[model samples]
Target chain A: MRTAVKKQYKVAVLAGDGIGPEVMAEAEKVLQVVADKFQFGLTLTPALVGGAAIDASGEPLPAATLALCQQSDAILFGSVGGPKWTGLAPDKQPERGSLLPLRKTFDLFCNLRPGQIYPAFAELSPLHPRVSSQGMDVLCVRELTGGIYFGEKGRTDTDAFDTQRYSVAEIERIARVAFDAASKRSNKVTSIDKANVLQTSILWRETVERVAKDYPGVTLEHMYIDNAAMQLIRSPQQFDVLLCDNLFGDILSDEIAAIAGSLGLLPSASLNGNGFGLYEPAGGSAPDIAGKGIANPIAQILSAALMLRYSFGEEDAARAIEQAVQQCLAQHIVTRDINPNSTYGTAAVGAAIVATLRQENR
Target chain B: MRTAVKKQYKVAVLAGDGIGPEVMAEAEKVLQVVADKFQFGLTLTPALVGGAAIDASGEPLPAATLALCQQSDAILFGSVGGPKWTGLAPDKQPERGSLLPLRKTFDLFCNLRPGQIYPAFAELSPLHPRVSSQGMDVLCVRELTGGIYFGEKGRTDTDAFDTQRYSVAEIERIARVAFDAASKRSNKVTSIDKANVLQTSILWRETVERVAKDYPGVTLEHMYIDNAAMQLIRSPQQFDVLLCDNLFGDILSDEIAAIAGSLGLLPSASLNGNGFGLYEPAGGSAPDIAGKGIANPIAQILSAALMLRYSFGEEDAARAIEQAVQQCLAQHIVTRDINPNSTYGTAAVGAAIVATLRQENR
Candidate 1:
């Protein structure tokens, strides 16, 4: 008999504020079950962050926590900020102090937000039944660090101006992220830009087209930003992955989230070039539901799955976790957030997902 | 006995290409009925434009047509461009040649697009029945001459840039248009911008606030572009007049049009500082449906109604024409576009609206 060595991975776990810790506890339970079933070795290092860190060290992101993250493979982030930290200076606020600085330190540039309408939860969508019945599963790959938001801006006595600048290197990197993501999902990527009028968009389209050549199996198409906005609402089933610059992404991603039904079920990941990422729920910490034991844990659990797939390249483990979640939702073993009348609590929901994961064979 | 002199108005009618002629004839019939009922003197001068002008004089906007437009109080434009004109040079293409030049020559800086969903046609909306049941009526007031679209743009060896520049005068003028439009409708205006990130948007918000003081009866609110996009889908009934710069408007207006059911029911207006305006349908000229007599004429008829309200300031006549079209749609006397299986043609739909207008006591 030959001795087998399991693949080992390290992640910095920062369950930030309010309901963060409660939901994160459930996520941990589910993650542990997934690791055991997939035969992977996991090392989760817990750290203080957000309001909790502010109380301990008078800083939202303590130096010790930053050092821990620097040594880890990825960061599994929970929802941050609460009323307790509202009095702090804007820069010292939990969100701005932690996430923004972490992104800068790691050079995290690509943001992936997956908006889906599961057939079981299709009724949650705001679209007419006729449209929502077709279902939607769109992944928005947005360039996070560049574009007009980070470009030069100034104001004269009577006029104000902002520049939207993009280099070929910047466009190429983001395009690759989108294409790579599409190859993993539906094999189709729609690059969105305003090519007809803006010089930057013209360059963006050209660069994206060049990058598409590398991913031979992925189908690539181009869409104007305005048309993309309408198409998302008119026919969301037609899209699999949407590649966009910062400004357009900021608008379209929110639209995608809105049409995806409940915000509590959405997960987001901001990744650096080296595959390291900060994964979190695309929602805020609800202080009111902190210890209620009924907060939904699906988003937090999904974030862990994203960390597994993007940072660890454990696609099997990630898909298993996702399918487990779907099974729980299908069985109505959900928290109050997803179903107000449901009797299941956060722990029960996570336990249900874990039980489903254990039964699903690879 | 004192003789009452009817207010005389001269309009240059440019029924351009494809289904433009057929639709314009129906629009003219409705306009005539409304004018007779409202007691107004009207002079409509027929002129060639788009592919028609290109064939007649090898120019999409012939010099004679420009002269005719300059002599009139307003321009009633039908759809422009078709396959026949696609062979022309990029600049000489029907739409690029005619509308672009006309907008530039007249300095038409304000664009108004009203998107509405009547209770009878509520089933046409893409929103869930629970959300669309409330109905929607939003007017998008867009600044056409400023913003990133027309701002300075250039490309370097590795980078490309586009500037989003706005002056106090530019913001103030568009702000006034929204406020004035709100005063006539719901007495509410929602100005959309990205003030948190862009200097131009900050100036835009400040200028709009200062302009709000001029209209005390109208309520004003500011929203980020991203949030505006989401809110439009989540709760469209909350909005009335949407004030936006060129880029944001381009996206939101298309979104509004998409949610309003059919493109054949939407109308647009472009106005200069002097009140001279150009009114047209938002949909394109359906070359395939041309000369079939089955094309929808509601949009063209509504364009004539917009001309009466905005340029001629014949509010009563405009309201009567709008109500007549609604009554016709409610009765299901619509063309193939609105109801494909219906046997009604362009002439029948226009005649129904004309009869409805004559019967309605305005």
Candidate 2:
């Protein structure tokens, strides 16, 4: 008798603090079910991070946790930071210490923020009836580790300055990420910048254009940042992928996420030049609702699904988890954040998605 | 018979191109009536600028026009540029050549964008039902002359850089402008910058704090640009005045204007430290709607009101003009953009406001 071998992969899971563990547990359970259904071997190595790690080891990003992530194929990150870590030094805070260092260590230069909305949840959208009626699904591909944020900045006797610097290589890589994302979706990308004023933006536009040659199947358009912000509010559905630098991306991504109505339901992925990635919820750790059993777990679960797709290269499994989450919403199985009257707890919503996957397995 | 001495003022009107002449004619008519009623002497100087200037002369911002503006007390500018000038070089284009040079010439360091929404038209807002129910009325005080826009920019072999520089004096002036604005309104000013990340922002926050002392009546708060964007969409009415650097202002002002439903309904004023300034419709010259007689003249009419309020110090006259414009909108005496099925045209809307003012005068 011949037996099929399971494709094995090691996953590092950091269930940070507050609602992190609760949400992370549900995501893990869903991922386990997906793996079982897909015949893939997946082992989750749980570790300390954020305020939890700080309390346990007096540091947000523990050396042991870093080693675990270094050895793993992918990272499934939970929300970090809470009131407990508020007094910590700027760089030592749960968010800054763990997340920032992780991105730097992993060379996670590109962050993909997808503002996707299901048809059933469109009513929750903040847009006008006519604008939301069309629906919005825009992905903001941001160059996370560069631009003004990471530039050399200081104050002189009379003047203060921050250098917004970008190289052709940096722009090329980020542009490729956007183009690649566009190729998978609507095959259209809008490179957003202030090229009329910023020299970095001029280089960004030129590099993005040069990178577009490699993506012949993808259509490219450049838009000024101001007009992009207005257009995003006016007709969000018109944008497929918004390729932007750090500052513009920071603003546009938040704008797009807010437009989606439910920030707790959005999943984000940070990627390096290689296929390796770290996936997490776009929202922060809800310390106020910690251990309440009512915290929204959809973002965490979807993040796990993203981990499977982007890092594990298990696209079918990712889609199955995504569809399961969407189906749960259709069935009105959600947490309080998504629906104030929702009866389902975090565990219930996770179980519902797992059950959906189990049904597909049969 | 003792007669109040007529206060004399010269307003340079640059009816550049497209519907510039059409809408400007209305603004001038309303201003003339206001001057007559308010017992003031006002003279208008029609000068050439933009593509129209290029048509009459060899340059966009003709020397004669600059001299005219220099001689005038204030500038009441109409819209500029059209398809006819699209083929011109980047610097020679009407928008770049004329508008930009005018800004530099006058040191128009502060741009005021008031996103005031009348309760009667809140249905046009794109925000969620709950968000727009309160209505929005926020003024964005943008530092127009400095920051990354006017900073040094250069390109190396593979990299491009733009230096975002801000002097103490620059930040102080803009901050004072914001605090002064808040004094007249809700007495709350939110200074937006990326202080946690950028050096310039640190200077900005400090300067704004120092300036807050000068206006003890104003409540000052600092917020990140990203959070500011979210808060604008989530609860715009909470903000009384938004103080920001050039780059953030460019993005946020447009965003705030978009939130108000229509750009064509917004008025803008660019001012120097002196009372001298230029008032223009925030919306672009719609070459498409040039001679249609269906273009919205409300913005231009409102621009004239802003000129009265900011440049000429005619508060009652400005309020009267504003009330008349609002009354026109309420009465459905609006152009095609505001109300498609309405029978009113550009001339009708302007004529309606003038008639309302005449009735008020009687």
Best by DockQ: 1
Model 1 spans with C-alpha error above 4 angstroms: none
lDDT of 1 by residue, B80-159 (tens): 89888788898899999999999999999999999998888888889888889899999999999999999999998689
lDDT of each: 0.92, 0.90
Task: Note the residue pairs that clash in candidate 2.
Answer: none
RMSD of each: 1.2, 1.5
lDDT of 2 at A41: 95
Off by over 4 Å in 2: A1-4, B1-3
Instruction: Point to the candidate with the largest lDDT.
Output: 1
Measured by TM-score, how close is model 2 to the native structure? 0.98
Residue A166 lDDT, candidate 1, scale 0-100: 98
Instruction: For candidate 1, list the clashing residue pairs, or say none.
Output: none
> Quick one: best TM-score, which candidate?
1
Write the residue-wise lDDT of candidate 2 on B74-191 in tens digits: 9988888999999999889998999888999999999999997677777667776677888888989999988998888899869999999999999998888888778867999999
Which lDDT tens digits does candidate 2 get at residues A97-138? 999899989999999998976788887777876788888989
